[model samples]
Target chain A: MWHVDEGTMNAYLDGELGDRGAGSGERGAAERGAGSGERGAETVWEVETHLASCAECRALLERVKRVRDRAGEILASSSPDDVVAPPFEEIQARAEARSTGSRVLQLSRIKRLAWAATVVLAVAVGWYARGTVFPTRTEQVSAPLAASELEESAQSQEPGAGSGEQIAASGEPGADSREQGAGSGERGAEQAEEGAATVVAAELDRAVAPADRDVAGRGAAAQTQTPAEAPSTEVGAAAPPQAKAEPDAEVKLRQEVVDVSAQRRRSDAGDRLAAAAAPQAVVQQVAADEPGVPVGGIAVGEALMFEDSLWIAASEDEAQDALGGDVPVIPDLPVIDYWTAPLHGGEMVRVRQRLDEENVLELIVSRVVSDVRAAVALRGIAAEPAENEAQIAAKGSLEAVAIRRGDLRVVLRGPVSTDSLRVLGEKVR
Target chain B: MPTDWAVVYRETYSDLVRFLHRKVWDIDRAQDLAQEVFVRALDVDAENPRAWLFTVANNLARDEARAAVRRKKHLVLLKGEAEARAAGHADPHAESVEERERTDAVKRALETLSDTDRTVLLLWDAGLNYGEIAEQSGLKKGAIGTTLSRARRRLVEAYERLEGGHVARG
Candidate 1:
């Protein structure tokens, strides 16, 4: 008697090995496993005789049956009718579309490669032509130039005819040519500074408009002072002749512009930082009937110390005045006593104080931050799952919780119980 | 004698789509591939039309499976999923969240199996006989049962692991 392999036994269990034309003995074994009666009774008797003795194969068969049954349940749930294929017309249209799409994609790829190659060739040709067409200009000679030559050179470099006359009239023919070059460069630098100062002042004025008119006024004064200091500095530097006046003026103007632009940039940057750091206020105004706790604004970065008894409180009006906006209020909860105040940062923090019968106080301070992800890595709290959101798990004695609510993240820190923390977190609208 | 093409189309179209749906995970794509099989079948004269149909459908599915692998950066597939949802193409039979999740878990589990195992399991689920599946899969007719057994065990294990991940994420 040939022994049945595990695969044959498994197939027999699935009722899949019934008619595969195996050896008569193997077929009898499969027929017995499939529970086929009457016609295969002799075969069943023979298979059962083997099964009764082979404990290992019988146990393996039971395990295969369990897996097959479970998988069968999963497969049966996915009905063909559950997915209604589009009408035949749509299927035909899609097949045709796919055929056409592949052709179009191939053509488009070829077109793109050709266009790219052409663009590269055009860019290469343009760069080479630019190098040949525009050769570098020669330096000016120290020997005094005739008025016409100076005018031509000055007109080419600078459109201003006045600059040509200054160089021609200097009368000193052997003045270092390098000095003249330096003077021209200094003047160009000065003009650039003046332009930059004007733009910065205009931008600052626009940036600070209406909200801080005083800041805009200072920015405008700085703009004007930058160009104003340039001329006097130039006069002192080139005292030889007024012909050198332009260079001295240019040098001074350039220096003043740099100073003013740097100051304006720093001021602009500070204002931007302040605006960005302005805490996001999450407000739940106190219920009119209950009036549980009054909310007040506290200065930014300053923590209000509570001695477990004095409990300094502020009304909504006081909080608004302090925070420059409406204050976020903490909801009343049974297990915890709430003392609320606005922090100077854009966020409002609610401190929950739990007082035991012995008068030992536990403090939990929570606030909204712009991002919860940035604060998730605090020293103690690990993230855990809560309903609809995730909460930070408390480590040992220190309990900290942070949950994201829309664009803002509400964080809680203290020894508050998990239930109390979740209750408060949900209250942050 | 040539086969009756209309009779063959009428008999085989729905099963072919159902078979492809289990492979592709998208009903629209399955229907398109099924129709494409018929379009190719218009040119063939086979004595065993049913086996021939399965063979050609398998080839088309294999080609698409390879193409999908090559196009693994799924920005297009993500956009397609979003568009499909908007168009109400999601599983209509899912009655509850649990059922939908189970179906999704099963689909993901099927993805983890070897291509042959997945094909055999899906073909069996689509009501293919062992002999027909063997013909389509190029496995011996007697070996189909063994393959099905291995495929079922692996699928259940993969599915359980995926369900565990969902719990962890939650």
Candidate 2:
């Protein structure tokens, strides 16, 4: 006298109630009724038995059948106009556009990255030299000239700033130099030996600018900083002649400064406060406020707090300026902050942060290069190749969304949905 | 081995577009999105192309929905202007007002169901059998029949309610 439930009755009507005889109750019910000629029949036998005596369930089945019929008719009646297939040509063009757009974006990203790295290294060299190279002369220069001419001087000397005295002078501020000179006058030789080692550490920053053609020369310059090297081989001797020979060096210096500043403009103004000068204040504040942790090979210096209020305060113009006229295609997001460092073979690592509506920070890590072979190389221990390279995959607890768009291999991480991550990944370039 | 992308595209394009058209309400957009699904598919090596297409198509539709929210006001203004243009001249559209009413009625009916139920019903309508619908919808195969039955019943009830209102107004 057991009657089938509504769900079972529905399954019975759809012929989906195949006999799951692993269940004892279902098996007993099937055994009590029709012998197993058909599995579907055996599964629905309980329902069939109830329907033979119960007009209520039979009427319900009839109603369900009618409803299903009407739904089918309505759906089928949709005009072909409502679902016209796009011409194959249009589809192909769209496909080509997607592929080409990604390629173009990647190429553009590589070029932009080169420009960005050039600017960063130029800025570091410029700022480092201003205090040490010609401290008194730099103070007398006009502000605009100070920014541009000083940068040119740095670039010219960049090839040969290898003397231990100049290295110690450049690494420390003007005040620190005077104090060290006064305090360590008796130990001048020992101080010079230590300064030589410090100069090598500063060369680490030089390695971050891959696009710079003088990488080999810079490496040579670093080696020349050894105290063992004769004072006669000081880079200052080579700087004056090189500056005189490269007249367009000033124009190049200005252009590099303009390009670098423009890219920095895409991020928040709070971050821009650090870019114009040595950001000694910002770096010091960050160091005091947040402890550094190593992620991958790089040390994440500070946790940039993502605030919804500040995010809303960001204007559209700044974003456009940062991207250098190519607007960030991602809607309602501004690049909050960014960091760039060099990778091997004329490639650079670019990290950008953007906040979602919920104020969760999404970090986009990209290698701006023409080839993503290095990016794919890191995927060796990944579970399996996804359907496509861009598809999101779970590697351990972290979900890594890797996209090889043009030359950029973008990996985005955050507490966002996969769809959001996908959109954000596409916008990295 | 996975089916050739060209073969999968040819076999599933129409059904996929139809399913998307119901979700998006614009044939051209649905078709464009359909092509995007295939373009994305070029990267995916799926065991079941049909299931993959539907899943990707669903995600694309969700993205479109988010974007549409930003354009809703602009669309409302365009709709008003179009209606004003239609009033000034005899409507030249091939379908009569009654046909538009019936189409809107079906849309409203489908809209009444919950997301899973509606998705199940639409996938079923798109010619995916119970097992296929289960894979696409992330529902169990055995439960798909129950889901379908419930969706069909609700859809009919909603349509009948709308029809009753139309008759009353007339």
User: What DockQ does model 1 achieve?
Assistant: 0.15
In candidate 2, which residue ranges exceed 4 Å CA deviation? Answer: A1-60, A78-84, A87-93, A136-429, B74-94
- In the order shown, the candidates' DockQ scores are 0.15, 0.25
**Candidate No. with top TM-score:** 2
- Misplaced by over 4 Å in model 1 are A1-3, A18-49, A52-56, A78-80, A83-429, B5-7, B66-97
Q: Roughly what TM-score does model 1 have, to 2 decimal places?
A: 0.36
lDDT value, candidate 1, whole model:
0.47
Summarize candidate 2's per-residue lDDT along A293-350 as a digit string, tens digits: 1122111111111111133322445433322333323444665654332222222233
Cα deviation of B140, candidate 2, in Å: 1.9
> Which run of 10 residues does model 2 chain A get worst, by summed lDDT?
A299-308
**Winning candidate number (lDDT):** 2
lDDT of 2 by residue, B19-101 (tens): 88788766677878888898888777888888888989999988777655433422333346575445433423326777667
